[model samples]
Structures are given as C-alpha cells and as structure tokens.
Target: MSEPQTASAVEEERHASWPELFFDLVVVAGAGLLAHLIEDGDGWSSLFLFAVAFGAFWMIWTCFTAYGNVRGDDARLPTFLVGMAVLSVMVAAVPGIHEGHAQAFAIAYVVGRVAAARPWHGATVVVDLPVIQAFTGVLPWIVSFWVDGDAKYLWWAAGLTIDLLQLLRAREDKLLEGAQERLDHVAERRREQLAAHEERARRDGAEAPAMSARARRRQRRIDRLEKAGRVGRQIPTSIVALRTDNVHLAERFGLFTLILLGEGLIQMLNAASGAEWDRMLVVAWAGAFALIVALWNLAVRHGSAGVALLAHGAIPVRVQWVAHLVTSLALVAVAAVLGVVLAHPARTLEEHEVLVLAGALALYLLVSATVHAVLARRGGGVEDGRRAAWLAGAGVIAPAVVIVARESLSAAAVVCVLAAAALLVSVVDRRARLRLTGARDGRAVPASTP
Candidate 1:
C-alpha cells in the first residue's frame, strides 16, 4: 500500500510567501537608489559606487535566497524575517554610505548577517567564504567615513575581488573533482542517512531496513543530475549542484528578475514624472517603455529566455547563476539609461552620456545573445533557434544605434534607435515561432510552460 505523502509534499512544494515578497520589494528600492546614484555622482565615480553597493546587496540577497531555497522547515520563517528587517535598515542607509551613516550601516549589516547564519539541517556554514566575503564587504563601509576619495572605493573593490576569487576557485575545484567523485559523495551521504534510519528501527525492536524507496529515489535523481554533462551544450562544467525540485531554484531566480525589471520601469516613471507632454517626448517615452517591455518578453514572458536550466541535465548549475546575473545587471543598466534618455528627448546628450547609453544597450544585446545561444545549444526547441537568430540580428544593429546618435542629433535619437532595434527583434521572434512550429521530436523544449 502506498503511504499518503501529505505534509512533506506540502512543505516541499511551498512557493515563496508574502513576507518574502515584501522583502524583495524592499531590496528593489535599494537597487533604485543605486541606479539613482549614477545620476548624482560624477560618471565613473557613481558607476563605481553602484558596483560596490550593488555587489553588497547582491551577495546578501543571494545568500538569503539560497537559504530560502533549501531551508528545512517553515519554523525558521520568523527568524528569517528578522534578518530581512535588518537588511531593510541597511538599504535605507545606503544613500548616506558616502557621507555620515557609516556606523548605522555597519551595525545593521552585522546583525542582519548573524540572523541569516541560523543553521540549516546537515549543511555546514562554518567555512563558507561567501559569508566571509559579505562580512568583509561591510568593512569598507564601516571605515568609509574616514577614508577620503576614490581610495575608499578601491578598498571595497579589493576585498570583493578576493572573496569572489575564492568562491570561483572553490567551485572550480568541485567541478574538476569529476562525476565519479560526486557520485561517491552522494553514496556516502546516503550511507549515513540509512545507517541512522537503521538505528531508529532497531531502537523500536524491529529488523533494520535498507535505504527507503524515497531515499533511493532521491539518490537516483542526484546521480542523473550529477552525471549530467555539458556535452550537448557549450556549458563546460557545473559550479553548483542542482537536484530534486529545480522549480524551487528557478522560481527564486524568476522572482529576482521580476524585481530588476520592476526597478527599470520604476526609474523610467520617476524620470518622466512632471515633464511636458509634447509629441517627441511622447514618442520617445513610448519607445523606451516598449524597449523595457520587449526585453521582458524576450527573456521572461516568452520561452526564449528560459535557461531550460533544470530540464537540461546537460548544462551546469553555474551557467544558470551567470545567466541570471547577466540578466539582472543588464536590465538595471538599460533602465537607468532609458530614464536619462527620456529626461532629455530633444537635447543632444553630453558626449559621455551618449557613449554610456550606447555601451549599455550593446551589453544588453551581447548578454541576450549569450543566453539564447546556450538554450539553442541545449536543444531548446523552436523558440530557442528563432530567438537566437533574432538576438544575432539585434546585436548587428546595436552599433548603428550609437552611430545615429551623432553630436548633431538629440540624445532622443538613441531612444529611436533602440526602439527600432526592439521592433526588429520582435519581428525576428515572430518569424522564429512561425518558422519552426512542431518541428518534430528529439529537441529539448524551451521551458515554454511554467
């Protein structure tokens, strides 16, 4: 007789809750502040500040998110909220980071981190370098009030680099440890689990049993995921181990991306708040808004954006991380640029500003193309092929966008160029779908359904 899998199934399949959603919204506010900094501070300096601040926010968010993904029970929910509250306070102080709120920011960051460190079952956080990195990242902010000028940012940058290098290198070591070694680790874990179960059975005056069917099923899944190679796609190796329910991880990622897109749209609205409603501004506004919306469809709404991460056992976990990171940062930058462009529709952009916008759009295209390429290589059905080609065409046109925004033309011209590019990509996208419908089997589905 099959045992009814009720409570465990309910807990495991639980989606993110209202509290977590609120926490993410708070962090989105922080992202907006970071982008706004670029408008205030001198160009490169502001950009540097955004990088350092964004890096810190991203690290904290990523840690908490991972914890959320694999956390054992709902009992820790309140404790997690305490951590998020402290994080909210820290985010509020970010605007004053270069000024007087150093002490407040430092203390809040430490408290939030301590709360985030609450133990997870079986998983040890004792030597986690990423946590150490997050703490180290706060050090510069602590003494930021004393250190004057760009040298301060240098310290933050140096500390961040050290922490990142360690994480990357450690992940690389695990990847190179090879499939046999990974399988061995899985077996060892299984043994420990079964041995404990046997002890319990004996204590109850019964015969000790072998690994249960559920445990066996989990191990088999891990084996399949671990043995999943990067041969079909260009993803060489996995830096993270993703097994069991991948929707858990993918859902978290999708939430974060939605936040980034929201940040862009929010900035755009803030930029156009009370400005005059002339014909040119209206056209430029619509175009910039469409650009943002089109981007969402390209990756989030449509199947093209699907990393097919969990489905394609052939790809590595790190690819998903990298892809998500690229998507977040690119969308953030696009939002910031669009806001600036919308602000001065008829006026020629400062030479530096024009250059920045051009570079940002190009970066967006490059990252988009990369995401699509991975999906296509993974055999992500018709949408993948169609979207990949569309991305290629948009990339080709991106440069021409900058050229059109010559010194003689208004900065608004850049908006026009990007809009045109967006439309062109849409056309390609439609063509891709129509051109490759039901192209038969042996193809990997592009995660079309939720």
Candidate 2:
C-alpha cells in the first residue's frame, strides 16, 4: 500500500484557478474558427496557410500554458486575459488573411507571442529557456509583411520551423546541464566527506585514511571548482522563479484536450442541426461522439504517466511539450475533418478529406504511443509496451483503412471505421494495464478482466 499523503504535500499539489479555465474559452473559439477555415478552403495552399497559422497559434497557447504551469495561482490574470484578446484577434484574422488581413495576422502573432513571453521577461540565463528560443521565429513572421505573394508564407513557415528547431536544441542543452549539475554535486559531497575524515582523525589522534594520487587530484579539482563557484552559477534564481508544477502542467494539457473534444462535439452537433435529418448522418454523429469519448479516456487516464516521467527527470520536459503540441494539432485537425464530414454525411468523402482524417488520427495515436513507450523504457513500472504497440498498430492501420476504402466507402462508413479502431485500442489498452497491475500484485488475473 502507498503511504498516506501529508498536509504539506496536499497543499503543494497545484490546481487550475478560475482565470486559467476562463483562458481556455479562447482556445475553444480559436479551434472552431480554424476548423471552419479549413472546412471552407480547398487545395494545398489553404492547407499550407493552416499550417502557418496553427503554428503561430499553438506557440501562443504554449507560452501561456507554460506561464500558468510555472506560476500556478500567482499567474497574473490580466496577462492571460491580454493574451486571450490578442489570440482572438489572431483567430479572427485567419479567415481574412488574403483580404489585407495578412498584416493584421502577422502583427497579432508577434504581439501575442511577446505577451506570452512575459513569464520569462527578466531571465538571466537563456540556456534552458525554450520560450526565449521560441521567440526567435517572430522576426521572420514580422518580416513576411513586406514580402509579396506566396513568398510571404515561406517566411511564416521559416519562422515556425526556426521556433521548433530552437525548442529541440534548448531541450538538449537543459538535459546536459542538469546531468552536469548532478555530477558536480556528487563530487562536492565527496570532497566534504574527505575533509571531514581528516579533521576527525586529527582531533582523535588517529591517522586518516591514506589518499591515493587519484584521490588527491580529485580533491584538488573539487577545490578549484568550489573556488570558481561554477555550481552556484549553474543554479540561478531564475530557475526557482520559473519552477514548474508538473502535475498541474499535465492537468492543463489534459484540460486542453477536453476543450478540443468539446469544441469538436459542438461543431458536429451544429452541423447536424443544420443538415437534413438522415440515418447515415446520425450514424456519423454517433461515431464521432464515441471517438471523442475514447480520446478523452485515453488522455485523462494514461497521459499522466508520461507527465510523471517528465517530473521525475526520466525525460526532458521539452519532450512532453513537443508531444503535447503535436497532439493538439492533431486534435484540431480531427475536429476540422469531423466538422466537414458531419456537414455533408450523405456525400462521398473527398480524397483530401480522407487523408486529413486518417493522418490526424494516426498522428495522435503515434505520438501518444511514442510517449508511453518512452515512459516504459524509463522504468515507470508498467508494461506500457503492449499498450503503446497496440495504439501504434492501430495508428498504422488508420491510413491503410483510408487508402483501401477511399473509393468505396461513404463518409459515415469511414468515420465509423476509424471510431471502431479507436475504441478497440482503448479496450485492449485498458485490459493490458489491468493485467499488468494484477501481475505486479502477485495475482493471476483473467485476461477477460476489465
């Protein structure tokens, strides 16, 4: 049995405040607008535009999420509200990008990101701060305004790509710095132990343990390290100021997933209400609802293990950040596709529509699978590989299902197929988890167990 939680530990557990929940409303609206934009557009150009806009918007959300995770209840409500306002402007500009709103979009993105960067305003060190690195992409986005035609979008893509590259690099730097800090602390403790031994021996009139040449060199190096104050410099007050509440951070991401699902359902219902009533449309709606339920269960139930891995230093926090980012994009893409399908359930699915839906589902499963696989490899003590593999296997099947059925299936049939795949994965994953738990408890539980 686990130990009981103490009052201090209970108090330390962070939770979402009202301001943060209010901030999520902006995401709901923004997701709906972006989905509508996609549903209304055609060809590769619109897809490209969506990519750029989504990147900027995603980074903005991440900035504020990170701020809240770091600051907890102390996070400034006014700053989040301001970020929300700018994000709304950015979302509104997305639909009018070609109608002289491109500049407005660009300006809003820059301002929104800067406002989101408020949490890291006075940082003394830049090594571990991916937010600062993410800001590097803003320059190109701002510069895109002066450029003409499609060439301008290239700038936007470049900016977003730069932001991703910087995030990855900063993640590596942080991991290395963290490892070095642990090594330095170990050496410092050894040095102190040796000094204490010598002092005690002298006081007791006993001969101290003889120091080897290697030991002497180690001590000398540690002495120089102490004098140089390298360890002190490595640990800056800024890190404390930016201390993250890992569980709360995970909860925030989970909440965002729910918002995406809720928005998707809203869009589906709205489309259903607008469309003529039909059996196939109802089937499609049912499948979509089931899909949303499966996704929610998967996110809320299993996602915390990955976050715990992040908190315990088994994985870099950036890994979690990037994973969550990709998951968000995929969820939005799924929502957009579902909205289109729900709007015209009687019609045959378009090739691009099939591609988007399959790709989004596959992306979500693959990303989640990868995170869980990492957790298992890092010794989280659950046999996550089977679940990870099951999700990945289902992910792999999603695109193939589309490829084989694209010519024959109705839109509703395709959706139902995907929903069935998701549900199967969820069921199999849960059983595997239960089996693992029972085995760990020294029981031979039936595979038929829930």
Candidate 3:
C-alpha cells in the first residue's frame, strides 16, 4: 500500500532544484579551445571560426538549460545530457569538420534538446517540436548543401535566431510561473489573516449577553469582510522571485565579463607569439590587455551592483532579462573586438580599421555605462551613476586622443595612457569599497553633518 501524503510532502515536490554546476567544466574547456583556434585563424576565416565556436557554445548551453527546465530536480537526466553535450562540443571542434560535419552536430544538439523535452510532454511540447526539427534536421541539411558563403551564413543566422527565441520563451514561462506562485501565496496569506480576525470577532460577539441574534449575525458579516480585507493584503511572492532571479542574472553578467577578460588575454598571448619578444611590444601587449580587463570590470561591477539593488525592488522579470541579455551581448562584442585587436594589433589599429574598432569600443562602453547608471540611480542612489559616467567619458575621450596622437605619440605614450586608465579605475574602485564599508559600519560622517 502507498504511504499517506502530508501537506509538507506536496510542497517539497514543488520546490525547484538548482542546475548542475560541475558539469559545465568540459563545455568550458571546449569553448576555450575553440577561442584559441579562432585566435589562430586570419580575416574571414576568423569570422567563420567564431561563428562555429559561438554556435557550438550556445547549443551546449541551450541544451543544458532545456534539460534543467524539464527535469530540474531529477539528477539522472541532467547528468546524462551534460555528458553528451560535452562530447558533442569536442566533436564539433575538429578543424574542417564544422561544415562537413554539420549534420552530426545538429543531430546531437537536437537529440539533447528533444530528450530533455520528454519530461515536458503534453500540449506545450508540440509547440517546441517543429522548431527543434527545423534547427536540427532541415536547416543543417540545407546549409550543408550550399557551397556559397553568404547562403551558409544566412541559414546559420536564421537557425541561431530561432534557438535564441526559444530560450527567451522558456525564460518567460519561468517568470510567469514565479508570478503565479507569488499571487497564490498572497491570496493564501490574506485568507489566513481574515480567518483569524473573524474568529476574534465571533468570540467577542458570542460573549456579549445583551446582543440579539440579529446583532450577532451582523457581527458575523463584519467578520467576513474583515477576513476578506486581510486576505487581500498578502504580498505577491512572484514579484519577489523575479527580483531574486534578476540578482542571479546580474551575477552571471559579472561572470561573463571575466570570460571576456580571459579571451582578451588569450588573444594578447597569441599576438605576442607572432612578434619579436622585445620589451616595448611586451609592455604594449600587457598594457592593452590590462586596459581591456579594467574596462570589463568597470562595466560589470557597477552594472551588476545596480541590477542586484533594483532586483530587490519590484521590477518585471521581462525587463530585467532584456537588460541582462543586452549587457551580455555587448560584453561579448567588446571581447570579440579586443580579441581582434590583440590578434592583429598592427592590422587592427591601421587607418581603415582603427576608426571602426575604436568607435565601436567607445560606443559599447558608453552604452554599457549608461544602462548601469540608470539602473543604479533608480535603486540605491546616484553614486554609481557618477562613477559610470566618469568612466564612460574617459573611455570615449582616450580613444580619440589615441587616434589623433598616433603619429605624435610614441608607443610608450600609448602604453602609458592605457596603464594609467587601469590604475585610476582600480584606485577609484578601492575608494568606493572603503566608503561603502565606512557607511555600513557607521563610521562615515554624513555630508550635511560634516
């Protein structure tokens, strides 16, 4: 005979499990290797290399996330999928195999996603099946047959776009689920509070000996209204869950920034390997890489902190996810630019490329800082905004100065400027930390008081 269930047992089954962390190790290794390979390639080849590498990365991540969505609390399915994705990434990494082996890669990816969807069987499963079939079966077959570069790229973009949309839809579903749970909790709490109030009123009325039966009945009605009002006062738990999710997403942004920094360093090493190991080139390479890392840190620290704070308030999950996705994309683009700069510094900073690369980098920094500043301003205060604005202004101005002074300034001067920026940012970061600590400890003097 089956054991009798309790309320706690039902609740226990509803709580979601955290996704696997250690399983990402192999995927990370595969991506790093792919980045290395891309760094080794030239011109259009590099673009092709990046497309394949990033596609592979996204595929692996998407599959894992899909599995988590369907069988999050089940350890067996996720573990098996992660192992398979790791193997698929490694196989996709084979040089020259990207185009020819596209079918196999697609099959592996499709199987991973489809298998994960097994647990999600029902009405909604049908909606996802067609998209999966297009990505894994039809798109790959079509792209493989097309010998032309433009056609292949077009197909790849379309397929990847669909995959991204699916991911977004999944996130939306999670947001809705959290919202529903919060609403339910609020209603339940309100009902409990109303019940308590009604009980108190009923007791008071029954104890009054002079009260008529009609008066007692009126008191009962009043108690019911009070209970309803109490029930209505419950806090929406879904909003709270969304906020928590945002904070987690913000932290993910910080992690991605670190990944970009690593990419820059890898590119720098690749560049140095090609040139003479002279002191000047070494200094330039180190300075440039450090500057990139500093810029990344500046973007994420302020941005993520702001996101974390705003997430504590009642913001919509959709808005938060949009902001997070944009920031993540910008970070990736910046990293790609830095990789190009490091890999082909001479070619990159040349007359034709300099204008575009420098401008793009400046624009990205400005936008990133602005978004973070806006979020920060809305949450805690304007301090983060001031800091972000200053950094952005420097990012814009320094590139211009570098471009104009290219002839007049020595390589040492360029290196010096980059080094100075990094140092200045580090110092400012430390000061901010100290000030925050002082305030937390009650050791800080208020501006008005001082």
Which candidate leads in TM-score? Answer: 2
The model with the greatest lDDT is 2
Note the clash tally of each candidate. Answer: 0, 0, 4
Clashes of 1: 0
TM for every model, in the order presented, reads 0.69, 0.78, 0.56
Runs in model 3 deviating more than 4 A are: 1-21, 33-56, 62-73, 77-87, 90-109, 119-148, 162-257, 270-275, 292-296, 299-348, 351-364, 373-380, 403-426, 429-450
TM-score of predicted model 2? 0.78
lDDT of 3 at 242: 11
Best-to-worst ranking by lDDT: 2, 1, 3
Worst 10 residues of 1 by lDDT: 1-10
Per-residue lDDT of model 2, residues 1-450, tens digit only: 111111111237767888888988888888888776677776778777887787788788877877776656668999889889988998898778877788888888888887776555332223323655256688898888798787888998999888777777655445345534555565466567656655554454433446354455655655566566433243222221234566676778778877877888888888888887889889988888888877777765555422211233345666666776777778788888887778888688898888888888888888877866876787755556666677888889876887677988888888888888888887887787688789899999898898
Q: Write the per-residue lDDT of candidate 1 for residues 1-450, one digit (tens) a residue.
A: 111111121234567766566667767777787676666665777777777666666666766665655543453667657757776876787788778664565566556555666543212221223343235545555565467666766766665565465454545333334433544455466556555654554454433345355555655554454466311222222223222234565666667767777877876787778566787688778878777776666556552223311233224444555455545666666677677777767877775566556656666676666666776787776566656666666766765556664677765667777767866776556554543453454454453511
**Model 2: residues with Cα > 4 Å off, grouped in runs:** 1-11, 119-129, 171-241, 304-314, 375-382
Q: What's the lDDT for all of these models?
A: 0.58, 0.72, 0.49
Residue 433 local lDDT, model 2: 68
State candidate 1's TM-score. 0.69
lDDT of 3 by residue, 221-287 (tens): 7556656443334332222211123333344445544565565566567666776656666566766
